[model samples]
Target: MTATATIDEVVCLRPATSTDFDLAGVINSLLKPVYELPGAELVHHLSGIGDVGRMIQDALDEAPDDLYATGVPSSGTDHAVWPVGGTTVEAGAGARLAVGITLPVDGSQDIFLWDQDASSDDLLGSVTISEAEQGQGSLSKLAHSDEEHSYYYVNYHVD
Candidate 1:
């Protein structure tokens, strides 16, 4: 008799949880080029003197590089706050940080996430976001790391 794989068996073999995905090679693939980019020193230097750049460089230097991640609701609430590490990235003051948040969907919501410098808002990069039905109450977070800067804002509705 020949052995055959069932759908259930295949599904079981696939990664289904965040931890499973985090362990997979996907994060490495996504982050390697970012750290290996040419003129890393120049970028870091231009970023100025702060622990934010150092922290990012250190994280990149590690064997398995990992980006920080956090999640929030898809809807509700007129105003929301997103702290780098749930507070200022450092214990001391005068630390400068300029991290960006890459939203799962584009044009889904205007200015979905923004830093203190509202006039210079920018998106981080492209990321795969799973499809969810409307009003499903699904939660999605703008995932990324940060530095010595302050809070971020999440505006759900325009009006």
Candidate 2:
């Protein structure tokens, strides 16, 4: 028997509220467009419209958080790591890791989500899947930090 697990995507429900700033003091917020237009153009068009322009500019200046994943097979001591997608995924966006692994029939594997940061990587959450869970189909686990939460979806099978 063989057991396999595939990570489909990581969905961000709500990002951490605390601003993650780089050395330049820029906030790393969500990268997804909130205003539907380019940030610079939006700021330019909204300028002289009072604090609304400044508010929009501030929101646009924020950058999305970078994320990645890791899978540790029960039979091995090393972890297989993969990037979620590009450099970052904004809140409310889903990033596809598409990482898969095969194991022995009786084996199990642990999957982890992490936020890559300039200082240090932060562990978002983790879940374990075993051969016993085969045929259960898709599984989702919600992992969270102090102020952020994300959903990790995986597909498991045994053959």
Candidate No. with top lDDT: 2
Model 1 lDDT tens row, 1-159 = 221111100000011112322333444454344433432233334346564434533333321111122233222122322334433222111122333443333324322222222243222221223333223332222222222111211112111
lDDT, residue 128, model 2: 75
Which residue runs does candidate 1 get wrong by more than 4 Å? 1-57, 60-108, 117-119, 125-132, 141-159
- Quote the lDDT for 83 in model 1: 37
lDDT of 2 at 95: 28
TM-score of each model, paired residue for residue: 0.20, 0.51
In angstroms, the error of model 2 at 24 is: 23
Backbone clash pairs for candidate 2 read 29-63
Every candidate's CA RMSD? 17.8, 11.1
lDDT of 2 at 117: 63
lDDT of model number 2: 0.45
- Cand. 1 Cα-lDDT: 0.26
